[model samples]
Target: MLWEALGAARDLGRVHDIAAVLIRYGFGDLVQRLGMARALERAGKVLHLRGQDDIARLEPAARVRRALEELGPTFVKLGQILATRADLFPPDWIAEFGKLQDAAPAVPFEAIRAQLAEDLGDLPENIFAELDTTPLAAASLAQVHRARLADGTPVALKVRRPGIRPVIEADLRLLARLAEIVEAEAPDLRRYRPREVVRQFAHSLRRELDFSAEGRNAERIAASFADQPEIVVPRIHWQWSGERLNVQDFIEGVPGRAVAALPEGFDRRLLARRGARAVLKMVLEDGFFHADPHQGNVFYLPDNRLAFIDFGMVGRLPEARRYEVAELLHGLVDRDGGLVTQVLLGWSDAAEADSESLRADIDRFVDEYHGVPLKQLDFGAMLGDVVGILREHGLALPPDLALMIKAFITLEGLGRQLDPDFDIAGEAAPYLREVILAHHAPDAIAKRGWRGLVSVADLLAGLPHDLARLLRIARRGSLKLEVDVPPLKAFGDQLDRAASRLTMGIVTAALIVGSSIALTVNRSDSVSLIGLLGFVGAMLGGLWVLVSVWRGGR
Candidate 1:
């Protein structure tokens, strides 16, 4: 791992300008804090340094922009995620991170050609009537070019940059190792386990590298929206695709935001509503959603349909979990503390939690915030608080759940950007209500009952064999029993021991009382032998009780 980090550091030397800018902005401090100072120092000399006061003098957003542009794509991507994670970074950092673009210097034409030929057989001319030499855009991982098939069908060809795969793999391994170290050393960061985050990152990056996966994702989404004419997904040229190269029908449309910025006659409001509806349908009805719904990934088709471009990041919610999510959202909207708590606990796998204490915490959260409207509530803040509480109580959300939350937030933000009046809750209400009702409706109930009856019948059909086995066991005068002894047995044993001691304590008190009474009644009598015996017995019993109690406590 150290060798890999050293290699990465050496690679950074090639981008000296970026390194210089990073140090000049105050991002160096973050690197130092993360224990990468040695790498930075080895990469290149710090040509400039920005002190805290200097950072204060500049706009936070400007400083961050400089730092991201200087740090390159990996950190830029990390910053973008941090921007969404209001629970992790400050608002200013989030804002700045959001502005970090994925733009990078284009690879040489020869390099592009070599990768294309390696991925897709011969040169562009062999497969296409014509291929543009100039790339339309260059990004961190790949660049896209305009091309046309022999049949004159226009398409966009995305080719991976030369030698990027190894770099990405190496960096990911380093990041995963670092995450393990952070998890081991820092309790607070354990909330967002670095290893898990790296795993997610690796999954995403791997999918991004394989054009086939993105193609399939696009196909699935396209099929889901086939009934909706307002949404369009581009066709993938599967015959020309490979792990490192993707060819798809080129979409010719203005970017979503650019379309929104048009004159009043454009009906931006309608566009926003349609887009929100499409995304919500994908999430609620289909249970699959595009994780990245930013404006860049969206385009406005000439026919007023929404064109979705990238499918690199997508999320799938299992049917059962989707139902749970629906219930959770409904509970939130209804401000039902008991229901929310029940759903949360059902979702959790914590076995050591004190149910009573958890219930109290839930009650407090709901009582404090349930009355607030969804629009008025700060979901980011609420989620942060909930996560903190869950962590304190030894509960953690599964990675998929966290990713789903991030996707929802991204989609919600995109919708709001398109239309300020957009309300995800309002848009989701009709669909969720129907789902909830169908789940509990009489017809559904009848279906469930019929299913249950069928299962019971099957069990009954097998009952004869079970009965024969039982009879055989009875005849043999032996039966095997399997039981999981209650885990509380240890506590119960301690309680039993305490009870025995208590009984001894009562006997001791009784003896002492008898001795006192005898002494008082027979004062000045001959020997008072019974009183002496009672007193001795009482003292011995009391001492025994005390010793037992002490031992039990230890």
Candidate 2:
């Protein structure tokens, strides 16, 4: 079905590959339902539907992870994106998704040299004083190499893998179509919001594909921290940067993953606190933050300073969302269950849920930490429990908030890795307080009031035209009113059933009377045979009436 609807011959090959991978992962039934198997078979792509017992024995989450790994870079990126959707998936699923590393075998320098030369506007040897042929790191989308400018400024050359755009774009097209098909055909999977998730992923991935966007992100974050010396964002060199290439000052420091390599003088506790504070400020105060703060994206410099790199994926919160987050944190800290419930309900997009049950759960969650000190509270655990409550009620957070929550959790985990006694809530307390105070400040209140007044003025200004249009439509007898009253509809259904039973009973009675008269007045063989048939039909109708009456208890 989707193959015909998609109508792209170029995607058929990708579909075959996806179907083969899914079938190998014991998801053949899904492929069948999605019509991939039939479509591919029709297109002459043979798929092996058996011999996956080894992989099929693993747990569902692990199997999915393995399948994603086998499916290539685009699916791995999808799995990585799914890791941030804790509100939509359980812990097991999220854990499996989190395990999806972007690591890939390095594409040899020679393969990418032509593209690099084009983006750099010169040969690498001509522009850089020293350029390493071997990549420092390789990922699904790009690889990094150490280089130095002609002026001896050490920088990192982030180069997009040659011919990656077409591959990724093709995958995105298939994913969008699959999401549509899933939403339309799979009722049970609708809660996952496949279409919405795909839309968000496409936007993020497209932005990530453009190295210039990542450069812009780095500059913005560096500007935000220009005054702070502790938080280091690499300086983006734009002269040689473009959609396919990013050149930035490379910080030489202890990689975050190499915790054992920390120098003896490094202050782990202070580092943890500083990290927490920086991220909290980014999310709460700045309304923009790096979405992926995993170990590989971070480095610890001497003097306990932190360097954050790789701004390919970032999150943004609008002013309203930031305020809502503050309110949520405020409610949790103050043990205000009502406020917490209100904010959570505002964030969820579920059409229907048990509100009273959700509120009760929130109240219980709040009471669990009623008197807990700020320093003793675990912000990560608290957020996890909140996500659990949302999941229980079949609610999912908006994509932006989901990314923010994932960042928060990752930050807390990184903090704990560095310092066993790290307290995220303690680090977040001051920022939350500032946000709450700002919300109530006189100027802020007056500004909101002024906006409200302006909105009302605009509505009042447009009321007369609306009334005139309505009056004109009414004069033309074109006005229509539609009402949906549940009780009335139910009553109407009952009346319809009663009328149908009454008509059936009347027809049965007429048949019985007519058959009896024919049997009594006509003794001829033909007439008698017709009367007997009528009698049998009347008996069958009577039985039907009796069954209906019994079933309906009428």
Candidate 3:
């Protein structure tokens, strides 16, 4: 019991920290809804952590954004990830979460020395000609420092903070547990499937934790763009980089955010087109893309090129998704509402809904884009409305597809920021056409058909053994089905007690009658064994009845 209490207190302590931040940011109602308030009660009563509920004054979505920010890095990463799921959240929530940043206090250089030495294989001075003791940028997962190679090649060294993994792992476990409880206790919250969301978040976060994988992503993307001089991928220093750190060629150029700061000869229109083209090739041609290419992750070279940084989080367009995306785009561009509805139904995880209604809603949506030239159409707005409709209908896109759409929106939004008339659809059309047509080629179709045939053949070959095993289990009387019946044991116990009482009462009454008969038949005898045994059995039966009654009462 003491150990149980200690465990409760520990959970409560962790939960109180989360609850206090949430309540302070105006999410107290949410906390109450999730039943976290009960857990926080003891903590809250001891100290008044509940201030004014921020939700009362600010918009709920805005308060949620602030709450996630104040909750720290994991939540911040969650909010950013949630920002990508336009199919699940409302527009205001997405906008607010998009504002979530990984900005964290810098780990002093001296504090990170051990990690640097371990990853770099020696002291920083020995490994580099010069290493800036100060960080160029500091984020939650890692910090970047400017450094120079022995041959004077400028590079950026990203060092992971010591002991960050355990903190993140603990938070993930807490989140998983909370998600389970919320799903179990709150029926209304089940639709959001908090458990599944946490699962997805865990997968993404784990990938982000590995710097070595991120380095490989960089190399793959760079190789994809090797022939395109206009596109730049900073070369990764594989020998010196590891899970603890990432070293890459340091890029010197104007930040993508500073569009107005481009030199006199720089062309904004050309830059926007080139940037869009580069991203399209990464998506449609290469099936890989920089998922979060906001202006902050981009750089504008003096030679009018676009340099992409930060490959930590990227999206892969599988051949299937790529094909479907092209169809989706084509459907929207041509006002083919039937095709649009088909694509949406394919991605829906919920029970099949009214197809006709879906078609009507999509037809109405597609009609809005009619007569607008493809070049003039706002893909971002169109996508937002489509996703909003999906959210309304309880449909969810796969994570990769959602991330792909968000990337497109970000790219288009960035392009328009640079030049109001820039059209991402126009820039992406040729590339999309090439890929879609290639997939439909006779050879591609034949290859896909043959793969399907092989899979079906394998399944058929395995069916016999599977059936034989099931038959063997059934014949041996070993086939058992376990079910989840919460009150089955209590019901069975009641039935057992009643049966035992009935049987005991019957036996007692029979023994009393039989003993009377034996006594009647053995009259005048010195001793009667039958009468004596009958009397003894009666007494035993009576005792059994009394004991059962007492046990039952107790």
lDDT leader: 2
Alpha-carbon runs more than 4 Å astray in model 2: 466-554
- Return the clash pairs for model 3, or none: 26-54, 26-55
Q: Residue by residue across 441-552, what tens digits does model 1's lDDT show?
A: 8987898899999999999999999999999998998987776444365467778988999899999999899888888887765437888988999999999998877744
| Per-model TM values vs. the true structure | 0.66, 0.84, 0.82
Q: Can you list the residue pairs that collide in candidate 2?
A: none
- What would the per-residue lDDT of candidate 2 be over residues 1-554, giving only the tens digit for each residue? 66786586888877888888888889988887777877886787788777466887899999999999988888898999888887778999989998898999999999999999999898999999999999999999999999999899999999999989888888898889889788766666787788999999999999999999999999998899989899999998988999999999988998889976798989999899988988998999999999999998899998889999999999999877888998998788888999988888889856577788999999999899977887777888888889888988888888999889889988988999998878887778789889888888999999999999999999999999999999999999999999866457657877998888888888888888988999899899988888888888888888988887774562
> Quick one: best TM-score, which candidate?
2
Candidate 1 has an lDDT of 0.72
- Locate the minimum summed-lDDT window of 10 residues in model 3: 1-10
Superposed on all Cα atoms, the candidates' RMSDs to the truth, in angstroms, are 17.6, 9.5, 9.6
Q: Which segments of candidate 3 are over 4 A away from where they belong? A: 1-13, 26-49, 53-55, 186-191, 481-554
TM-score of 1: 0.66
For model 3, the local distance difference test gives: 0.83
